[model samples]
Target: MTMEQICIRLVKVDMLSPVRALNRFPSVIRCCASARTDLMRTNSSSSLKSRGSVTAAASSLCLRSRSGLNTCITAFRPPAERVPLIIQPTREFHTSGRLRALPAPLIWMVLKPLQKLIAIILGRSIRKWWLALPPNKKQLFREWTWRRRWHFVGAGAGLLFFVSLFLLTHLDESPVTGRTRLLVFSRENFMELAQVTAEAYMEEFKDSLIAPSDPRHQVVEQAVRILAERNQDIAEISSVPWTVHVVDGPTINAFVLPNGNVFIFTGMLEAVADIHQLVFILGHEMAHALIGHAAEQASLSHVVELLSLILLTAIWAICPRDSLAVLGQWIQGKLVQFLFDRPFSRKLEAEADQVGLQLAAKACADVRAGPVFWQQMEIYDQLRGEPTIPEWLSTHPSHQNRVRQLDRLVPEALELRASCDCPALPKADPRVIFHQAVKLLLDNAKKQENIAQEKKNEKERAGVILPFPQSPPVLTQGSQPQRGGVLATSALPQTLLSK
Candidate 1:
């Protein structure tokens, strides 16, 4: 046969799809009569023995060639079964070299088109499902069927509502800073809450409460009276009936109600450097009431909850009311607590710091004591080796953060103090002050016991006949004094602990 005719019978296998390989291979060469004759005549026994060696060399050349092909000569096989690929040149041609694999780029080229095709099919399916919606729901899609367009519309509407609500409120002025704020609750509501809450606290701590006679009580009373009397701009200070209650406890905390009711724990007094630091702290607690932070925080908390609910509702609208909604709710809960509630709490704390600094400065208390008071607190926390919570997760700022803020506020407070007549008071060690406070209490108790003993001696000297030989001890008014220098009070119910 001629070379063109011989080439016509050769088949090239395409690895991509072997069944489709032979169509491209047939009839691919021009005639070469002499070359075909030489290729056809390898019948001698010697020539047959050398055929294998010659074939191996030819196959090596094919693989090493810069040009690639799926072509080779081999033993013949029937068309029904998979042909065994052989690499040799002889009179007969067999299956092409075991089909050449496609290049990486070519495989990617095929997949790219397939991916686009699948995406188009998916989009069409989503369109069909969308059209099956009730006619009323489809009204928006009548003119604009694009999925992204609807997303933008929903976002824009929500943003507009939020901006309008935020901008359209009446602005109320903060007491110390005079910064205007959007207050949701009335001034009257604060006093009402304060009155109820303060009375409940009073009833609970009535037993173990200290009187004016207690040195800690005397100091705190003196400070609150001076600060509240001077800073009458806060409605709570001016309108509410002011009362101070000192409870002997180890809990280091102080709080003031809008009704001008103050609760100071003995532990707080023990932590103070002097009456000035106590006064400075008292001013801070008072600021929380003065600035209406309680009411403002309550309002903001509700607003956050409402916004979260709205966002969840929007998610349910877009997503299937199934596992996706559950996931969204979990995410929303975390964001509301950590992002909205905690940060909002920190902001209110910072605001109270500024207001308290101003209040303390005006009251003639050493504003520098603010940093000192917090320094003591920081030390106490360190001694306990308490883990510091991250600012994002904690409701209160870290001690270092508070100390830095207090330090910054000091210069301004000092500038205000410079103009006042109260000369800077001498500073005392907090540890020394705490020791003295304890010693004073011991002295007072000893004096009271001595007075009781003298009174009993007088009775015996007067020859008074006792109705009962052993008299039951008469306890002091309201509260019972406990041993170990500790005091106990009848506390409110468990429900009030949450408050």
Candidate 2:
């Protein structure tokens, strides 16, 4: 047959096969065509030509069966043809080569215990070193006053310079909500950027944003409003138009913008067991906004960038070579991002936490929840098996240290809580709250089951074939199915999925 005829016959054979056809043939082809001719004699005279072509094509095709046997004309061909076919020995097919699998559990077993032991020893040594330090270190540092005058002068001068610069910048009212704000750019320009960023962030995480009417969204909004109203910093925030939004993510996080835009994740709602606990978290975020922490952080970051540029300029002036200047610039950039930017951010986080507690207590929320929340957070961090230093060195204070400080601040918090008469501050019993939560969970689960059953019924009523799962769904306590596999349920939210 001609090459085109052979190609057509091959296509027909492939279409008739009960398997997915290959997109393209491999570069090399090997098969036993001679055995196929001997098997075609049983075909009737009228069908001999077509049957012979099919048998020949099958014999020529380089297909392998699971049993290490080659595709025979009779076995591989359609059932209509009763022609017997013979198999021939051929070299094994190898695409790339077999890959060896690593024994992951074995490796983990050897490493995990060693890692824990080392961590324990190192932790003890560090504690000993810290305890051995002189108790008067803080006193000694506080007593040093040589640089106090210089610091005051430098701070005053820097503040005056920035104030003057800010005054020169354009001031305008926000578009979404008219509120006067200081900005280097015009309100229109700022909004354009804000809109672009908001749209991009929303699109990228659209699935994570809870519907406005979701119960969790309502909970977050209520907590935010309570915290905002009770805040001692309300006077500072009164001029700014504030809005709160709930992002529908399962990660425990919350952040506030300089412009009083607050975003809380559903994960945080699940983490916090009660309204008071939620208030503590929201109060902390609001503290960041009320104190102008975001602007302060931006200003510090800008200063760091400016310092890096100045350093690069100095290095270039000294070296006067293109290559040297480029190296200096690269090093300066990395130094700004790693050392100055990150360390400064961590300091701001600690400051916000310290101030946040004061605000929550002033709001008459349960002060005990602050430390308890941090303890729970520590448990999450431990389960994650994350590096301690990275978390400790983050923009926020170490969770353990924050918890310790919160414990120390309890008495002061209680005093503030006593002074407030907000009707929302009454403490609810944990057992009562937990029972209510369980009832809510059961009710939500039943609703979900009903919805699912209704959908199945609708498909059946339409006479449509519904595909049933081959295997039973695995249900584990505290476990949820991720995109790929099941994740341990402890990290899963205890609350039902918000409709």
Candidate 3:
């Protein structure tokens, strides 16, 4: 038979329904066996001479098919040069590729079955208990629920009691500052979270991270070590080992994770003037970690979210329209942020500033540099043409406010420094030097204003206008008295100017 004839026969067989195809499969296999023999006989005289072998092969296939259809089909493998015909249903049904079993999440796999088992047990137990209850008690419960709404009142009271107990149990005091705050998350949990957060940050800044061999990294490590060594009295500082990473980015920021990971940006390094200022900045970041502010903030956020959920449900149920419900939720969120979240954040910032000052002083750093650093930050913001965000709307206190707070804290910080037997502070206060510079700039501005006014009054004004002083007034130890005499600003404790 020709190949075209064989193809037509196979097509006719395949077009039949699966049941008909299976019933006729044996006859189709016989036809394929005959065709294969004919092709082999035509291709080689040697194969045609082996007539007994061909007859035996055909007999063996016939006998195998009676034993099992799948075994018979698999046993007959067509030559690669020949196209196979008459696919057996049992052969196709049984033949399978190796299926790869993907790994499932162990946590979810365990949890799902356990949860369903718990649900089943609880449901059966509850049903049994209900069935065992007295008829009178059941009727009384139904009547109270329908007429008095006792269920709602009981639910509310139960929720309130649970919340009160939870808050009381989680209330923790700061080890360093003695400030009490809610901390539903444990320290270990927060450390794990911090580790994940640190990993994310490291990944995000991977391409921008400075090498450990860099001088900046060395400087930061040395500074952190000095601060940690001097402040060993602080359990939080001495307990955990710190890891430092310097990110080569333009963002003026530094932060410490609860897991003792410190990230510093090059922009912040450029912004700071000297080593003392950097020590204070590091201390400030460390203070946040020492106080476990991350966990406290998370606990507060969880409480806020729970309260908001209740408020949202009430709003959605009470309001007739979906749009009104959405609007109400948005307003509630803003109110919570401004009234609760930001104020709490600012309070924490102020506390960190106070504690950081003490840390810097104990490290024998220039304590007066603390306020001066904030004043420079405020000025830097102004010079960069950045808008000043209202303190009420911001997470951190205004730089000016921080400068004032640090000024008030300076005397106490100095006392701490003296108690620690740190090297005596230089007689020239950075605060005094900063104030004199400002005074000099103001004087120069007034002089230029008078010159411009004089020029404006002339009948024939000179085209050439005098420039303001190019150099700032230098205040040497001897010049300090004279400058104070001119400005009438003493370097006394009370006259310590704030930003």
Index of the highest-lDDT prediction: 3
What candidate 1 gets wrong by more than 4 Å, as runs, is 1-167, 233-236, 316-324, 426-499
Q: Count clashing residue pairs per candidate.
A: 1, 4, 0
Give all TM-scores, in the order shown.
0.53, 0.46, 0.63
The true-versus-predicted C-alpha distance at residue 125 of model 2, in Å, is 52
Q: After superposition, how far is residue 9 of candidate 1 from its true place, in Å?
A: 99
In the range 264-364, model 2's lDDT, one tens digit per residue, is 87677777755657777877776666555445444445444434444554555554454765676577667677776677667656656666777777766
**TM-score of model 1 relative to the true fold?**
0.53
Give, for candidate 3, the lowest lDDT window spanning 10 residues. 480-489
Those runs of model 3 whose alpha carbons end farther than 4 Å from true positions after fitting are 1-146, 149-151, 456-499
lDDT of each: 0.61, 0.55, 0.69
Please list all clashing residue pairs in model 2, or write none if there are none. Answer: 208-248, 209-248, 478-489, 479-489
Which candidate has the highest TM-score of all? 3
List model 3 lDDT by residue over 1-499, tens digit each.
Answer: 7653563355344433433443556555545455554434343422222222322333222111222333222124345543333333443235679873422222233455464345434444555566777999999878877886787889899999999998899888887778788987777677766776788998999999999987788778777887788888888888889999999887889999988899999878777766778888999999999888877777787677666655655665555555776687679879999988999999989988988888888888888988888887776676555788899999999998999899999998999888887666679999999989878876876777677566655624656555533322232212211111101212212211110
Residue 385, candidate 3: C-alpha displacement in angstroms: 2.2
